[model samples]
Target: MSQKRLLLWVFHSFTLIAGIQFLQYYIFYNSSYPFPYTANLVNSFGTFYTYLLLLPLVFYSAKSAFSNLENRVQRMLLLVLSGLLVSMLHLFVMHFVNWLQIYQWTEDPFWNSYRFLISKWLHFELIAYFLFVLAWRFLVFEKKGSEASKPEYWTQIKVKEAGLVSFVPVEEIRWIEAYDNYIKVRTKKDKFHLVRMPLREIEAKLDSGHFKRIHRSTIVAIREVVAIHQDNGQYRVLLEDNSTLKLSRTFKKSIEDSIRV
Candidate 1:
């Protein structure tokens, strides 16, 4: 990760924990018989800062599990285990901090309040652990998707013809259609070639700016598209070559976004 991304990730982690802590503090402080304002603020934010100690553990474990575990069940098991370990470490740290800050103010020994603290915060701590995991997943996937959106599309498709292999400029191809197990790559001049490739695979290779899938088994060149006709909520795409193709209901929104009309 870059320095900028690292800082952004840290900011998100702190924001999540700080927001939760603020809400928790506000609720407790507004209740009847609340503790003194100074004590309440310090104790609440102290716990928030202590949570910072486990942020590294939470993010590192989540990242490791996502990278190493492909199975959903395995990932969940590893995350649960990591969450348990983080909670254990947090409990010890919180106990030590409590003792250090309140030894002069309270009579309760640190060891004596272990069970009380567990009862008060164990479930909530586990909840916070899961929240950190969710935050990591959201940030990581959004970054990956943002980068992948600007992919370099294929320029030329290899063509194997007769006993010799050739090349077809992607611009010359008018549309592609699925023909049984292979795809029929058709050109504007009415010539066609069959290739052992899936429609979806070829569609991914094409630039969305130049070609758009109008159906599950059909992709048309944007320049070849002349007009669209609609009737009874169904759509048909008319091409300049006098070929008309079904504009599937599922792909209607995709066409609208691509054509911007």
Candidate 2:
């Protein structure tokens, strides 16, 4: 995540925590709660402040633990582990702060307080972790959907061949072939240009509807496909230049759909 985004989350979380704690304290103060006003206020403020101090660690760990995890079981395990670690850290810091306030860092009383706090706050801490993860996932999903809906207009691709630089217009390109650590750009005029870039990287820059990957080694422009021939359960893509390229069974359906559309 970018520093700006991290800072924005921190600010928003702080505001949310503060607002909730304030309302909670106000409700308790007005109600017939048994707890003393001073003690209630102290605990409320302490809990909120403790979470504010731990926000960075929690956010960083949650992002690292949940991001890119595809397995459901493994992701759940990591989430539980991360939540436990964050809760333990929060408990330790809260106790240390309390000890500082009382000027007593003794062992027995600290352990007792720690146990009590854990028993009372553990479930809440886990819930907080899940809530944060849900919000982060929602934001990411929305960002991806917004990007996918935007139109892509690629004009040209810059290519360097033999120490000479040139710009190839997107429409003139007929097909592209993958070479080891590079790609061979083929134009409609039957000219070939070598570019030192991966075909997958180049593919991402092209219009998705216009260019389709027919095989691991070939990506053909949809407009340049003259015909598709199938024989013996295999397919051949015939391009406008009369060049035949093998169409992998994996991408055959996608290529056919794009052409049909």
Candidate 3:
């Protein structure tokens, strides 16, 4: 991904988490407690705990939506199921801890009371599950909106008939070598087509997760980078195939930043 996009996704993730907390707090506080301001704050605390405890849910939901789930139904199902499971686990632990307190202190406040614990837990489970659904919807909407807003040039690829040829999958491409007006996409299997597209144009067509510009005429795939070695203060990516590609010092950090592992 471009540096700008990576930063945007990070910001979006935080915003979604905060938004969920606010909305869930509003719903729970209004329904379960009578106080306006104070109950709202308490609800916020609950949502905070929910966010902290359910961090995996947020990550998985994003991963499922972006990388795995192909349909909206599956995405929503995963989000809801994961959300409910995480919430129930938190609720059980909270109630169990409260039970330990009640045994030691001999207090009864319905807040932690066991009289209708099952029903109350179920209620909160529904609420937490709804929060996850809201998050899923938000991500889907954001993706659609982003797609709609992209410039036409980014999605439209120029067609040039290159007589019975095969191209590489965007994922398998490690780098592209640009010479004059033609760029060669290098993959694990072999060097593919020599297209007349500019490196920038081809980069736009490829998946950002797999390809990134490391120099004016070079782009590298993070997955294929086996090692980053320095030679006389210059950086180079040693690939899985034992091939080495030079990384320009100017864009070295940007390339390094995109490597997830």
Quantify all predictions' global Cα lDDT against the true fold. Answer: 0.79, 0.77, 0.64
Highest lDDT among the candidates is held by which one? 1
lDDT by residue for model 2 (1-261), tens: 444575577567666776677678768563775545554555556766677666666656656655667788887788788878887887777777665655263565877878888899889888876776666556654465467778776678898977889999989999999989989999988899888899988898898989999999998899998888986878999887788889998998999898889
- Kindly indicate the candidate among 1 and 2 with the higher lDDT: 1
lDDT of 3 by residue, 4-108 (tens): 353356456656776677677677666664445544553445434544555556555656665677898887777677666676666666565545534335556
Better of 1 and 3 by TM-score: 1
Report the C-alpha lDDT of model 1 over 1-261, residue by residue, as the tens digit: 432475466667666776677667677654652455445555656666777767778888888787678899999999999998888678877677656656436777666687788878888889989987877767674465467778888898887878788778898999999998789999967999888788889999999888999998999888888878996778999888888888998887877776674
TM-score of each: 0.53, 0.53, 0.41
After TM-score superposition, what is the CA distance of residue 105 in candidate 2 from its true location, in Å? 14
TM-score, candidate 2, is 0.53
**Superposition TM-score, candidate 1 onto the true structure:** 0.53
> Model 3 off-target regions past 4 Å?
1-144, 150-162
Best of the two (2, 3) by TM-score: 2
